[model samples]
Target: MPSRSAAGVDRRTFLRYTSAIGVTTAITTGLTACGGPASNGDGAKGSGGSGAGTIEAGLSYALSTGFDPMITSGATPYAANMHIFEGLVDLDPATLVARPTLATEMPKKINATTYRATLRKGATFHDGSAVTAEDVVFSFERVLDPKNASLMAQFVPFIDTVKAVDTGTVEFKLKSPFALFPSRISVVRIVPKKIVEKDVKGFDAEPVGSGPYKFVSAVREDKIVMTKHDKYNGPHPAKAQKMVWRLMSDPSARVSALKSGRVQAIEDVPYIDVKGITGENKVESVQSFGLLFLMFNCKDERFEDKRVRQALHYALDTEKIIETALLGNAAPATGYVPATHPDYRKASTVYSHDLAKAKKLLAEAGAKDLSFTLMLTDTGWVKDVAPLIKESWAAIGVDATLDIAKSAAQYAKVDKGDFHALAAPGDPSVFGNDVDLLMRWFYYGFWPEKRYGWAGSAAYKKTKSLLDQAAGLTDEAKRKELWGQVTDLVADEAALYPVLHRKLPTGWTTDALTGFKPLPTTGLSFIDVGRA
Candidate 1:
């Protein structure tokens, strides 16, 4: 396996690749808890558990990225960062609905273009610094700075400026009236200004936030150690004394750890093993908005025509792939957004599995014998589904070879415009749930502009204008109407579209862990959850 520089990949690409690294570990590690609070400068050590107060979880992701809320991109780091940091308004771990965390409540809409947030008075960072309006302003400013190249900035283009109105009040003036402004605040988390100002790089390496847990250390491909932040005074306090997230990327290792009592909970449980795990160990497959999407290199002359893209989608037997490869843990994508979402709308051009239509379309497009490399991530589920896809394409006279690698390496090729088509799993629901934010993630920003090569097209420009116009409108029904139009255009274009929306399977000990719920998003959350 070759290594690639992770310099330019976006958050979605970063996390997708992060979850794909399945490094196998033979032994489970125990957390060594700190007796008392540790300063932010000196790293805190985690404590061990006896399946009582302290909790251990086997995560299927490795920490390939940093921990800065503004920039951290990998799956594990993002999950851990959720416990270590918080935003003015944070999404509920189980249900991705935006709620208050650092703020007393969700940001209040003062006017059409302005919103106000009041910080909780007693909240403090892991470093023991007060969470103030200045810190909130600094957090947003750092992300908004172009020189920093923060991945979060793209999601918050509505903010014109963030100013401290008082000690506890922070005001946001938007570039325009963004209807999604309240929920969108979750995108940029609040950070302590002094710690980050001292050394931004150090803060990225050892993040200090006001969440339930404080970061202790992160050993790549091994384990990330965290202890309860004793000083944290907030709504969601740490329920367990310590949490040791063992990075057992291999599926068998995770199940083994869970069964052997080395871990109380485990994420990304294999579909095959779900029925086998019994008694004290409980397994569940919760429906999620996460998906495996097919994106084409529109710049490639072979895929320049819309007909070829649609032909490729039609060629795949999605229903069969869902049943066989996913073991009935997923639903075939009916539209741009999944049906589980609140704003789900069926697209006008839905691709049902049709091999005959695919062959006809291929012949019409003058591509009777087409051959292309289908790039994919090394995620356990994705590898299982990759062959099924190849076989489906083969049935339609398409020679599709697999280019399987860690997500970072595969995306390196995608980023450089060196790949023809890609099929990979992604979870953008972590950032937001609205149709506009979800659509804009791939179609509006750097993704379309750089990676997919569709920004220059007239269709792409029209989609952008429609999204912009919709964002300004205060009417909810009219906004969705415009969003439906964008979905129709993208689905018909087929440059990038979903194959299926999957159910995230997570297994945990019913007796050992309490209040632990499976999340619809990629990462795990332990807020308000405890060990039995």
Candidate 2:
């Protein structure tokens, strides 16, 4: 699931490593030459018939991970999971509004700390098993089990126990009053107990769910195939009977595929090509909460002092980078929440570019003559932003050496405390849009406790407490007020702060497909899309 930062682009690593191994040529030879557009595992021609609708699209990312909604983190597979698996309630692909999917309607509140949901009648998994209350209970239990290490568990800390009330009804008992309980049910997707209980690892590779589409076959960095679940009786029925996601990691290749009539839509459209692609193809840059985050190894002596972290944020020319490096396709990260979010609130401690303030803070922290290695991911946009960060720090009398590498490789160093700081793209928007969920993604759980080395600190403990208090509060205004307090403290400390929120650019032939809107998250979604 995206809860684990899956399929989020480590764009440069995917492109570079694939190119080095002749992956581009391999993809071309494997897919293009097999009959026509999409190829099945047996190298057989796809059922791209006229009446039975089919949509072929290019994705900027490769299948670098699994498709399990509980643990999958790669952007490509995360997107695919949306089509194959569904929760009781789901965030609409475009609007982020909570909508009922597996359940007949929103989970009704039985009490302040309990909720009840009745599964939709006749709903069945792709394997043809009935969608029973036992299945729902099993799904939630799997996530709540600490031994499984399911990333989805972090998002639903309010859930104390999920029990089967009847054959079709399920009840959830919460530890406290959670305002977003109804919508938060979307975090734990319902999976068949029989299938998963037998072969958990095999299910991750070839998933079987009760979603609109059924997984067919997947070849990493090549293609992912799916067919419409004819038995699907959901609100958003599959408009296209089949979907072929061609893994085009190269930006130009995705655009070229759209132009050459090979694909009807493409994701991660290059900023440079937004205006250049004309005629039937159109590009739209959807504003997203996806951000380039700046995090420090808080365990390190130099960054242990919050002032050092603040100094780094103050030194960056954020506005200039957004305008120049991002081609004005991003907004300055003024707060934890982006300007586009409905619940947007500007933090009290907004960091503006000020060299004097940065130097002063460094001096106060006893590190005026500072020098450290800045570890960065090699995503295309991150590469563009890296030099600007270096220049900004250098101007303030700080020597920052750039150590650019793949996200996983860089994280290996970060986890082991071998690096000073990190800059990379991340989007927790997939899990939720609320301030609490967003804050928890970085500050709470495994990320801070294990990876960033901030859990033991006083600041982290206070942050966690504030979040817990906010969760228990039934009043909406009070909850937001507490969130604002958290936003202020985190910003003031500047441990893991955002540099900017980027716009996700996507291109589609408007005339060729219907209901194919651009997404604000990492990967593309075609929930109710069909050929025109």
Candidate 3:
């Protein structure tokens, strides 16, 4: 996005009008509370139960899910869990390039279908076994083993086999051609084969890895304490052991915690609270590419009409949503894919607010009594955006209904085609527009063969074949060409609609935090977290 002209950070007329009414436009609130950290949410008290060297941080989700990298990796917003694990390649601070963490170098492609990788000799797991090729092979294989239930396994289905050629060397034989294989291997965090072989539940509770930080202790759904791994490889970490993670479920509670110095680095700063929350001296907010969208179930007869879908798009007041709901931190969306992705058509036309045009389209389709069910989780972010959508559709005479999938049933509902429209937090792509990324979340029959309510209908069946064909080809230009073809077709069909790319915002309390960067997975990790 730095290469393209960044748009509209300044206040707008609508924003000015909203400010007159006293509202937060994904705005920020001043946080000037100064003191040692305290625990705000319900969790085990003290920095650590033992009151040892621990750096305290706050997160949006409870720490019930522990440090099993493969369990909830990128596909979910569990960067905090990933913070406890180290992958083969870590995101470089200056370049944003994938650099080696466990492996010696970028994976070397022996041919169109095979890659050879070598392990970093001195790297050791916390249990002190030299990290070997076998561990890397086991981790990758286990994730793709179907029963492991890894959410981010779709990218590497072609991985036919992973054999440790030697203690330090391994081979990955793919079933098809993949030019971006190295990028795929970069994020798979290595686990000790010995530990997982014994207890899956125990490993999930307390896992060990060769990351910059080592896990100290964790109380399920409450908080986690991590210390700097003194034997960490790569650039010596600036932080010395002392990091604590407190789980704050409510956005306002997270804000209050930051104000009270109860925790450092809170996640999911509501757009309304971005400016005022980060206004504090210690808090710094980073606005990276966030993807948010309202998915249309292709199976539903109501949304199957292109005119009906287009009409819904025409009804939105995107600017107002940003001003009132998101505050001012988010940009309006037009494309189904993220605007920041490499292949995104930056100059493409945007779907601006047009009430008249929406009415006309609906009339043309004889879509007089437009009605649909949009289901989302019961979270603050969903509460803010979904109601705004319902009201916007109502203004155009569309009888839209808002539904809440009970917290426990939400994931199952979305993963299956059980709901009409659901909010999806798609994983961030390093290569940006890899075909797999787009084809998986949308389109008919999602990637890794999960049927999470894709646009499944007669119209989408044709599109899916073309998409599959594109994935099989290795020609870069040809691949880009196919991606454009599918995206254009989807847009022309109005098969999907984007709300806005969801952003993860956090504020730090103590300057003790370092090596913390905005990650693709919007969770906090301790790889670089430490007391100053």
lDDT of 1 at 463: 95
* lDDT score at residue 521, model 2, on the 0-100 scale: 85
Query: Cα miss at 355, model 3 (Å)?
Result: 2.1
lDDT (C-alpha, whole model) for all candidates: 0.81, 0.80, 0.58
Residues 136-181 of candidate 2: C-alpha lDDT, one tens digit per residue: 9999998888666566777897899999989999999998888888
| Per-prediction TM-score to the true structure, in the order listed | 0.91, 0.91, 0.80
Pairwise TM-score winner, candidates 1 and 3:
1
**lDDT pick, better of 2 and 3:** 2
- Looking at model 1, residue 465 earns an lDDT score of 97
Query: What TM-score would you give candidate 3 relative to the actual structure?
Result: 0.80
User: Which candidate order results from sorting by TM-score in descending order?
Assistant: 1, 2, 3
Query: Where in model 2 is the C-alpha error above 4 Å?
Result: 1-52
Q: 1 or 3, which is superior by lDDT? A: 1
lDDT pick, better of 1 and 2: 1
Q: Candidate 1, residues 59-91: lDDT per residue as tens digits?
A: 877766677777666678788888989899988
Q: Which pairs in model 2 have colliding backbones?
A: 1-72, 6-73, 6-74, 7-73, 7-74, 7-75, 8-75
Model 1, residue 148: what's the lDDT? 68
> lDDT tens digits, residues 239-346, model 3?
544466676667788888877767656766666666676433244444444455556665667766777777787787877777777666566665655565566653
lDDT of 1: 0.81
